[model samples]
Target: MQVIPLKYGTIFKRAFGQPDVFCQFTKDILGIEINIDKVHTEYEYPEPIGFVRSKYDLFAEDTEKRIIVEIQQVKEDDFFDRFLYYHLISMVEQVGGYQAYGFDRTVYTIVVLTSTPRDGSINFSCAVSDMNPIDEYGRTFVVYPHRLVFLCPRQVNDKTPPLVKKWLNFIEDSLDGEMDEVDYPDTFWKKIMAAIQKQTINPALLSEIKDDAAWEEAKIRFVAEGVEKGLGKGREEGRAMLLKQQRETVLQAREMGLDEMAIAKLTGLTAQELKKITK
Candidate 1:
């Protein structure tokens, strides 16, 4: 049986939007236990306090922490910077008065990337940003509790923790429409699997999936035609034209949220070549 992938924003929000599921996910991924009163999806602050307003995919709060979870399907050039801004916003919003210099709640920003990340150092399924103050002798002090965590399901390996790996594997399998409850024996996974079953998805969500598929197909055809046209030119001119086309396609695909591996296959470009083009 086919299951709707949680990588999609709509499906992701629907599945993890539940308070219990969100809490379980947080505990599994970050090793933090939070009893959130509610899970807010596509959450926006009531008033714009900064020069630019930020909308979060998932936002929740307990007494001592503010949680921001963002699901990113596309690999953008400024992916890191964008999330950093969101993380800061969550922290800054706590400022109420001039005398209140201390933040009451610690902010935790967790980013889940469905596609391969642009940073090569993030070669694992999960990683956390280090904000501890370190001395010359390597002694560290935890003055700051705010944290940033990144989860890349596409990068799972045997080294990955079993609890985290199961969730990452579930995400990978869902993308291929092959999610199985047997593989995810946890009760939490059972609930998530039932939540995103293809047959149970609403009509509107199914329509969105159909539209997205059509758009992806169109992008592939566009790349193919560009390659064909470039090959019809003079030998030397054709090579240059083809290179230009591939670069343009790479940029377009990145903006459309297409993963790097798929873009390389479609453009007939190697990983090194794609990196150069993107750079």
Candidate 2:
């Protein structure tokens, strides 16, 4: 059976929207117990200009902290910068409408990358203290502890914990060909698989998935074609520039009262080649 694309926004919402699933996901990423007060999907941050800004994949907050969960299938060069920007925006939105001395709650940004990064690390994390100096006890002035957690599905292996590995497998594996080969753990894997199966049956959801897939496919194709065209154009321009420089050199040599033979020796052009330019 074809599995739902977890990286897709609609499918991600359908598969993990359940409070139970989202809570489990939170714990798996944070490696700590969390009581989620509410879960919002495709949540729009408060745009001060009211122009409708970017929407997060998942936004959940509790009394102590707010979590932003995102699934990125394609890797970009400025991925870290983008996530940092998103993290800052999330923090800003907390106090957007209300006045406060500082953010009362911490912000956590969790990103699941379906693609492998250059370093091939399965997991990467960053915190404020890593970039700044702090004492052994840690800095007391830090109120909002913003963190970034990245999980690369391709790099998950036996060394990973059972539950974490299972969750990664569920998100990445299609479970189509080798059905009986791998035995997934009972709870989270089963819940996600069952939810995907159930959600796939909804005709509207299925249609939406198909449409989104088509749109994404078209986008990839367009980008690939654009890059190819750009490269071709660049090569053409490069050749033209080289030819112009060669011609300019020949003209410059002639201006200096040098014969065709001297120009040929200086520019590494044959006598015939020099004649072709002078002709």
Clashes of each: 0, 0
> Whole-model lDDT, candidate 1?
0.83
Ten-residue region with minimum lDDT total, candidate 1: 115-124
- Please provide, for model 2 over 1-279, each residue's C-alpha lDDT reduced to its tens digit, 9 standing for 90 to 100: 446757677777776777788888878767656687567988885555233366788888888888888878654667767777777776766664555547667788887776655565434322222123467787655433577777666667667666576667766674231222246557666666666663345898888878977987897789789989999999999988987888889999899999888888899989877767655
Q: Itemize residue pairs with steric clashes in candidate 2.
A: none
The TM-score obtained by model 1 is 0.75
Winning model by TM-score: 2
Best by lDDT: 1
Off by over 4 Å in 1: 117-122, 211-279
Local accuracy of candidate 1 as per-residue lDDT tens digits, 105-220: 99999999888745575577888885789999999898888999888899999888998887788778888876657777888788888888999988988898777667756765
Error of 2 at 196 (Å): 2.3
